[model samples]
Target: MSTPPRLTFVNRQGERHARKLSLFGLRALIEEMQCQGVTARAVLSGTGVLSKDFDDDASLITRDQRLAIYRNAQRLAKRSDVALLAGARQRISDFGIYGYALASSRTLGDALDLSFRHLRQAGPVLQITSRVEDGVIKLRSHDPESLGDLLPFVAEFWRSSNLTFLSRVLERPFPSLRMLLPYPAPPHWRAYGRTFNCPIEFEAEAMEWHFAESIWQLPLPNANPAAAKVCQRFCEQVLSEQPQGSELTDSIRAALVNRPGRFARIDDIAAHLGMSLRTLNRRLASEGLSYQSIIDDVRKTLAVEYLERTTLSVEHICERVGFSDPSNFRKAFKKWTGRSPSDFRDADLR
Candidate 1:
């Protein structure tokens, strides 16, 4: 089968994040329902994922599709707490080596640190930050990149799953967790009491979980600092398998494609992503690339595509590629391909 083109989702927050889930993650979501004896039809309806998709590790599903499947599971389970239950249902092993590294850490703090560094491997859009202040340990989950519509569902899923993971890490029912949820309380808000035995506050500006600093020293049952280090290295290797700057450059390309005639400001894209231009530049430096280089690459690639496949005028092509001057476009086109745009298009016509 032919592969579909990948897509980028820029949320209302003006932050660009992925709207897709790895097939492995989607498969587990589906299996969570099937294991509960729910029929496949209801779970799969509106999910846009086929049976074969679950078995294909390389395939992906959009955020809408994932949420629909979860909602369907909620309906099938006849409860408003589907996200709560399902999130907790996930085991550490579900994350593969990422979970293994957590289990091997010497302390909960180490495991949490590991999570902060590589959590994106499991959920790219979710950002988990950990800190200690005023004798309270705080862990915050934020998704500035998620659309407003999914704020509640996504936050609930991450929090519940995190609570489950923490309980396992500490090898006990985790200490009382004080919570602040970003959205309004739901009809099933009471489920929070039953599922999370803690003080809860809803409609807050952020999702914050506070715990006594004493929880930091709790030893993991499988604590082996040396093994944890080895595992951490492997976990990082897994994450680094992606070509660095891939996402950054791809986002630049997407912004350009979406706004054809206008050049996107690197500063604006960086700011919307809650990143400073310096940090972005440092990250791209590690990839041996820069923002303007990526923009130029995308423009040149698109220019070639337009020239070879279409009969658009050179002037129009120049405008479409964001060049205000036809002469500038001619200079760039020649510099990129060793020929003028017209010559390149005419050569292809032969």
Candidate 2:
């Protein structure tokens, strides 16, 4: 049997994020359900996805088709919380596939580096860029279009998510967070601002963050060579089934990291990845994603982990997660979990 393209997903707030179908896996999932007499197509269609394209190559499916699958899956799953979970369960099998690699890293920063390296291989529509601006290292996003009118919502979530994780990883509160947005203001600002206690910048071009540069070089407290080897082995095993093509995500992740350095342009990322800008776009299209989507997903996962595990102030967490403002993080967090970060932390702690 021919191998299918890999599957990926982007976690969107309010609406289901996005999904990229793997022709082989999708077909298998559908076929298995069909044999069992389950109307897989009907179920998927109920989720707003058409199941016909399961046979298409990952590179062959249209954006609308992939989006439909995501929408349908979210609808079928009912709770937005379960969309990523269900999607991961079907396409990824073991959540440990990517988490395993992270567990193996020498530090949170290293783990983040590896995440960017293989983001598309997992799924998600957020890009993470960790760089040093002035003397501070900032973790931020490169795309604005993806956030849409919900840019504030997305940016706030990014803030909450990244900072929450950083506190857990560093065991200390960051000095401050700086958010970058293109708009003026929103009504729910106070909820986010009070929670974070950090200055919120507005009308900026991109979602940027600032942290002490020292953290970038800090070794991951959990960096274990044995663990990393184990995780790497697991990733290789699962990813082995994937066709051996020049990995585009690796180059894209690198560009995101090296930003404010040598690679600050998407064209530069494309050039470094050894494909034309158009080809890069086309290849990402095949996966049913844009480079920026994966970046945001990485940021969200990390941000949430921070929020849950650490006791650092919310504003500090916001900066770490790439939000220039604390209020934005609050709105985004509420959208993601239907609960504010403070409420989440308080409930979980209690």
Identify the leading candidate in terms of TM-score. 1
In the range 1-350, model 1's lDDT, one tens digit per residue, is 11111222222111222343443334445566776787677688877777866554335455446656656665686556667777777676666667778888988767766776555545534434455677676766543223344556666666677677777777777786689887789999988887778999988766678887766676799888887888788877766663233656555555555555676798987875568999988988998988888777767866775675456789988988789999999999899889999888889789
TM-score of each: 0.59, 0.44
Q: Per-residue lDDT of 1-350 in model 2, one digit per residue for the tens?
A: 11111111122221223343233324323443344454676546634445554433332333334434444433444332332122222322222345556645776557656655554444333545455556665655654443344445445533554344344444454356555556676655554455445667777766666655555455655567887887777655555554333456544553543332122456766776667999988988997888667556545644555565455678876776567878997887787678888888788678
For each of the candidates, give the backbone clash count: 0, 34
**For all the candidates, what are their Cα RMSDs to the real structure?**
11.8, 16.8
Instruction: Report, for every candidate in turn, its global Cα lDDT versus the true structure.
Output: 0.66, 0.50
Candidate 1 lands at a TM-score of: 0.59
Estimate the overall C-alpha local distance difference test score of candidate 2: 0.50
CA deviation > 4 Å runs, candidate 1: 1-32, 35-37, 40-42, 45-65, 71-77, 143-146, 225-230, 243-350
